[model samples]
Target: MKRAITELFNRLRFKHKLFLSYLIVIIIPIIVLGVYAYKQSEQMLKIQGIGGIEKNVDTISGGINGSIERYNHSVQTIVYNKTFQKIVTNDYRDLVNLSYDLKEYLSPYFTMMTNLDKEIDEIKFYTQTYVPEYGESVQLASRVSEEQWYKEALKGTGSQWFSDNGIIVVSKFPQFSNDKDTNIVYMRINEASLFNNVAALAKDDTVIITDKQGRIIYSNQQASAAADKPVLNTAQLSALKEGVIDFGGAKSYLVKKPVALTDWTIYCIVPAAQLTQNAGSIINATLIIIALCILIVLIIIWIFSKTMLRRVLSLNSLMKRVEIGDLSMRVRSESKDEIGELTNRFGSMLIRLNEVIDELFRNKIVQKEAEFKALQWQMNPHFLYNTLSFINWKALRSDAHDISHVVTTLSKFYRTGLNRGDNIIPVQDELEHVRCYIEIIQTMRENSFDVVYDIDEAVFGYKTINFILQPLAENAIIHGINRKESGRGVLRITAELSGGKVVFTVEDNGNGMPPEAAKTLLESQSSGYGLKNVKERLQLKFGSDYSIVVESEVDQGTRMKIAIPA
Candidate 1:
């Protein structure tokens, strides 16, 4: 089985391998931990549900017991009151006088006791004597044995408790009256005020109070007429003594405690489903979070694998191109890791190979050009200079000074341009050469422009490539000065030694080119050869350290700066 699994893994692609790695390293462990956490959480919820139900039931039971004890105390107080007993057993010949006496004596005691406790609603004295009602608070009854509560009172000795529909505490006074009639003192408790606290405890549950005969007299849901039915039958009530019961088609937790004063039982019934609602919600939320986490992790894994493999495939494609003799192919990477280093090395190898091929090709053309230039230079200059000098002399003898000056300047321009077949010459000679070229331009243009020279004496001895400044001056005059709408221009040439370098500038106050046009002067195919030739020769001789920079703006004129190492 292990061999089969290994074979399957080996047959998969790199992305599949990465997915398997994540499943083992991240997903499986999370799933295991999530299952364990779910089980532990379920167990914890069960224990907590049981504990919480038990606590609430104990609290409600204690509150109910305390209320019964307070009512029992009230009953005992009324039963032993001598004033009340005397008022009940008094023999009055004048009925009006007796009624007045009853009110004066019993009214004060009932008012004082009932005022101290708001739970007692009515205090009544039931007897066979002719007693009129004093007020609604204290009642005098003529029939003692007719009422059900009175009959129940006679069955027990002291403080008999009964609730037919509402709570009543009845106590009989036998010693006070020797007649066949029995006098009873009973106080009816205010049902709402007596059980308000116990009812509050059953917010989402059910609380029921039943009499000794298992008849439910009070309930938390008493306001709802539909809930008036008995919740537990006698069999279920008997079974509830063990702690829990299944009744009314729902599993419920039952806590039953007997009220010592009334022998009634208070039952707190909580549904099993209600107890676990919060736990179920929590488990569902945890499941959603776990699923989202797994999805996010899978997305991250896919993106990472795709990015890494794409780079590797790009390098492989470039290698294939190189293998097919496309040596110009290169990998472009900015990373500093091992893959980036490999890409860089591969790119460097291609660059070197291309450079070797380019050098060999350039050498052959250079050799042929050098031989042709040497042959052309041997014949052209001497004949050209002699012809120009003859013209100058002939013009001078004829008293044509302008013609003589133009031919003389033209001769000097060509002589200096040759520079005795040398590539590098003194800075003074190059300046003199540019001056001659500018003079010829002035003569041809009817001297419409002015030329200024600002040369530092210290840089006069510095050597530079011949014809460098002459092309720049010619470019300024032809492209810049000649195109001006004003037709009047100024040309300035300056040279200075700055920071161990020879800085030369050729500037013109004329119509200037746009910025894009100025940038393309060095790179444009349509740009003339003169400026490009000078730039190339400078780079070839002095390496890339020396360069010419052109700055121009429309209507702002143009300036060209040439920098060479001193």
Candidate 2:
């Protein structure tokens, strides 16, 4: 069977093979997935609807319990009040004194407690003693002693919640009172305040809250008709399990949660068919999507096969042309596949071969021109040196000693600065270069500043870049000593070796600058051939680790230091 299949596949063209392979690999899986999704979507939607209803029931139960707790707290506050208990339990002789205590104290306290929570409609106290009613807030206990809700509150140790006449009542007996003298404090809350918090989450669902005895405390839909009635008859309530149920001949989903600290259960009911209403449309859309994907895959397979064949044929023709010595033609491909890579490699080989042949002839022409330029550059510097020498000789013959001295000093400065076009020189030669610059400056300024060299012998043999110290010396004389008002200024130069590094320091006691001026001296562009040029040259030769730092204070001397690896 395998041999037969292989023989059948080998008989097909390349495009036919690709189309058939894609049909089996891609289209078949999409169809299977679409069928599975169609079958599972109904059950999944039903499960999600039940889960959402369960959360809504829990939130509604929590909101109801919160309202009950708030009313209970207000009752407890009045029950434990010493002043209230004393007033309610006292045996009064005059009715006017009783009315004064009730009107002056108890009325304001009840009003204050009721004002604290917006949910509380009224707060009232029921006393067994005959304390005639002072407003509706103080009532006779005998009036409600025989009532069912009051009897139920007496049976419990703490507060009890009751739904009576569209209002919620929280009743608690006084802590200090005996059974014979029952003082009950009860707070009434409007039922709408408890239901409004969870109503938004229940949207289209019906919620029923029942007490421990299966009596419905509140029903969001049927409350006006069935308040304080049984949630359902015994036979029907037993059949109302969670998940799908047949309620009044319609399929529905039911979720139930118990309220904490209260024996109340909350029920949320939603229709089952309402939850899965869109399942049919989703199944039809899946089938359409599977068909569209198969059509697109087949179309893409055909175009891709045709494009591959055309590019392969073009590459073969180009290779044949290149075999006969034509290197100007180049191949172009936008794809990142194997065929594109092969075409690009072949084009690169032809380009590299042409470049090598052209570079061989160009190198010979450049070498000859460089030699001619070298001969031309050597004459200019020698001509300048000979002219300086002639000026020195004329100065001495004409008896101008100062002119001869200045011309000779200028000659030494240029010669050491040049250094035969070599950047790296001995430390001694760099010192000599700076010394010549200082002498020229002193001659121009008539020896106004004294020079002091604090040299360490160890740094003399080390190598450094030439013409570095000349700018520092020139700045010390021009900006420093020349600007001194009264006394002669002093310039100090120091060289030392420490921790595998060579350090040079230039200090001047002339009219000193502020610290800011000294620090930014190397960064200013106005100083031509100054400290900034020296810093760049040192960094280029010795890497960035070498640099110059400056330190100065107002009315004090300025000191510039250079450090480099030895």
Candidate 3:
């Protein structure tokens, strides 16, 4: 059997083998993960559903308490009223006075209470006084003496709430001055008002309110019925906890809350299947996702294996050509995988081999051509200097000393700037270059700006980048001195060795730019390339540690400084 399996695997194509391997590796774990995720999602939904039901129960309990509170307040009002108590407990000498008192005071008070709180359906007083019962509003205590709610109210010093025969009752029994007069004030609450909020619950959900004795006093299912129906049997009720339970052959989540006024417990029940209904769809989606992932992975394996095989075959063909001494063969690929890497290395090796074989002849020819080019370009700078000298001589012969001086300064500036194409020169030579530039500028502007040199002699021995300060001085005269409104501008050029580093500063007393403009002067091309070029040359010649800085203030002067390592 093992041999047969091996033969089958060996007969399969590379992509097929890759696909099979991936399938075997991922199928079991993906199934397990999908199942686990479904269970966890279902559990989370159950917990959230239970929590939601608990909140609803709390809200329902609050509404019921509010409805009961209003009726209880009415009962207390009638019980504590001195006049109402006196009227109810009064020993009437005649029926006419009793009738007059009821008509004038008692009747109007009850009517006002019922009108003020629409939830109060009726208000009745039960007493055993000799006074005759007027209407249904005034009744004999003996009529309710045997009732459970009445007996309970008589036992407690405070008020009591009772759900009896689809009616909500709040009663207050006050200690009367006459022992024979057991006075009770009763206010019946509108059942609709008591359960108004519970109507928002889901249709399948059920709410049950039970008295302290574990007897159902009210159920939404039997709300209109005269007698309360039992929702759960005795066994189920006894075994109920604040969690999932088996009810009516289906799993239901139950949350219970106690009513503060009556000590009654409110039970909220919802089917577990309803709570986790979405979990089934989620699981189905997860399974579909897993299947898609498997399909995508198989496709990727096939594509990758095919690509690798094609690249390897191409590499083999290139090698065969190379073996036939075709050294110019080349391959280009943008892939960054191992095969691509191998292809790149092979191409580089072939190029290096060809370079080694041809390097000697190539270098000799390049050297000969370079020499010929040098010979062709040797006369340009000398011709420029000679022309400048001839002009200076003609200017001197004509007695134009200023023109001669300007030409001489220009010649010197160009000579120092060239420095035989050397990038580094002595600090003294760089300083002389700046002086030449300033002289030419002053001659052009008719000495509008005066320049002071505070260069330390110690700096003269050090070598520096050529033409570093000339552009800076030019910028100072152009941007600063020329823009000054009043007073002659002064240019101060200073170079010194401080803290083992060379520092150069060019300060001009002219109309300075804003501080922000000064900070970006070396970076903005709109200002000109003079300062920016100097900055780039310094950083490139030295490392990035060397740089230029500018400080300026509006209406004040500007200062440019360059710092470089010695």
Candidate 4:
């Protein structure tokens, strides 16, 4: 058996074996892929088919609904107008008599509705007679004398309605009783006019009109000679349910939405075959190409098997260049289409990826500057503590006990103000710091200034950025209070919390600055100098939402409001 097999193989020509091998490699996968694509294309077709129908339905429905509302407004105007009612009750006038001149009086209004509302086929007018004998000159449709709409109008009910058989209509009931007996009149709107407003989408192949029932009253068909197809059946209609289902032999898709002005359902249908028909053409072309590709693949496999070591070496060199941030690297190719676009996009992505890596490395330096900035804060407070501690200890050794008490209180102030390296301090600690500062100020000059703190204890524990309150306190002292009457410069500080923010106001009973000066001080472009510096730093640390606002009147003292996030 082995001898026979070897002889059979030797008898086959090299070119024949090559072609057969290539066909096995290329043609088999093509057939497999084609089958898969065919299934997917069918599913997509159903969805697109259903979508086209649904979009047309929505367009028509919205347009029709809008036209009904507009027509109702026009008819309502005619319903109450005395002259229009006269045209109905007395005698129907010629088109020209209903106007101001010898020309048609209601020329614009009636013509726009009747002649322009092309979707509507007719607009009916009715008087007191239900027998339909009185209005024969108007050329009435085979008398709707006993129709429900006529009966309803006689009973004084105005009909703004959507009717069966795909009709949308609105009417006005005028019960006019002047000198004699009472008589009712109805101004009927042409159903087609409302439909005409939406005529653009009405003629599409997938048009549908659903009544109050969840069923189709009208569907699309053309003026072909063939007899009309029966619309839909029970088994096919079952696919219109809310979940996915196998449609007819060719898959179908469905969607449901409520019909306008009524409790009706609109079901959209899509056929799967329409979506994926192109895939069949693709499959045939792919089969022919695969037959050619099979010969090429066999030749390549044999050549590569002989020179595997050399090709492997070239691949190693290329990979090494790619590893060390060489993003422009790409394997050369001659073919065109999707594969080429994909390789081009991948090369572009690598270039962008390299740029992002470089950017991240540079941001680390900005992060370092922020760290150095935080360190600067530590040194200033540490200097204040050392100086205050020496003064307090030296005063204790001497007999000046009041001085010692002052220094001790000042030391305690810094301790609470700093609070073991915490960046945020409570409002209570801030208030105590202000009280101690006031004491130190008093020691300098007796009764030279008066300070008051009107702080709410309930709000003391609310959090604020450290030192935020003290700077504003100092601003009022330097710029507001110190410029007052010689004997007593009054400074008042109040702190409260409302709506999840610490709200502080510092006001002084001193001679306020002129409007221009104060405004310039607040409005200057350069910030972070004295009061400006504190405001800028506060904003940078906490953002614009948590910052200070200033308000003042020239003689009425100055008030500053601090809004800091809690």
| Model 4 CA deviation exceeding 4 Å by range | 1-387, 520-529
* Candidate 4 per-residue C-alpha lDDT over 219-260 given as tens digits, one digit per residue, 9 for 90 to 100: 543311133323564344534574343543445545566656
Predicted candidate 2 versus true structure: per-residue lDDT over 30-118, tens digit per residue: 77666657665565576556766777777777777777777667677777877677666665678776777788889888777668777
Question: What does candidate 1's lDDT look like per residue over 270-324, in tens digits?
Answer: 7777777876555675676677777777776777678667868889989989889
- Clashing residue pairs, backbone N/CA/C < 3 A, model 2: none
Q: Write model 3 residue lDDT over 441-547, tens digit each, in one string.
A: 88888887788999899988889977678878888888899899999889999999999998999999988999778867788754433777677667666767887
Off by over 4 Å in 2: 1-43, 91-100, 175-179, 222-235, 277-566
TM-score of 1: 0.37
Residues forming the 10-long window of minimal summed lDDT in candidate 1: 222-231
Ranking by lDDT: 3, 1, 2, 4
Going through the candidates in the order shown, the clash numbers are: 0, 0, 0, 11
Question: Regarding lDDT, does 3 or 4 come out ahead?
Answer: 3
Clashing pairs in 1: none
lDDT, candidate 1, equals 0.75
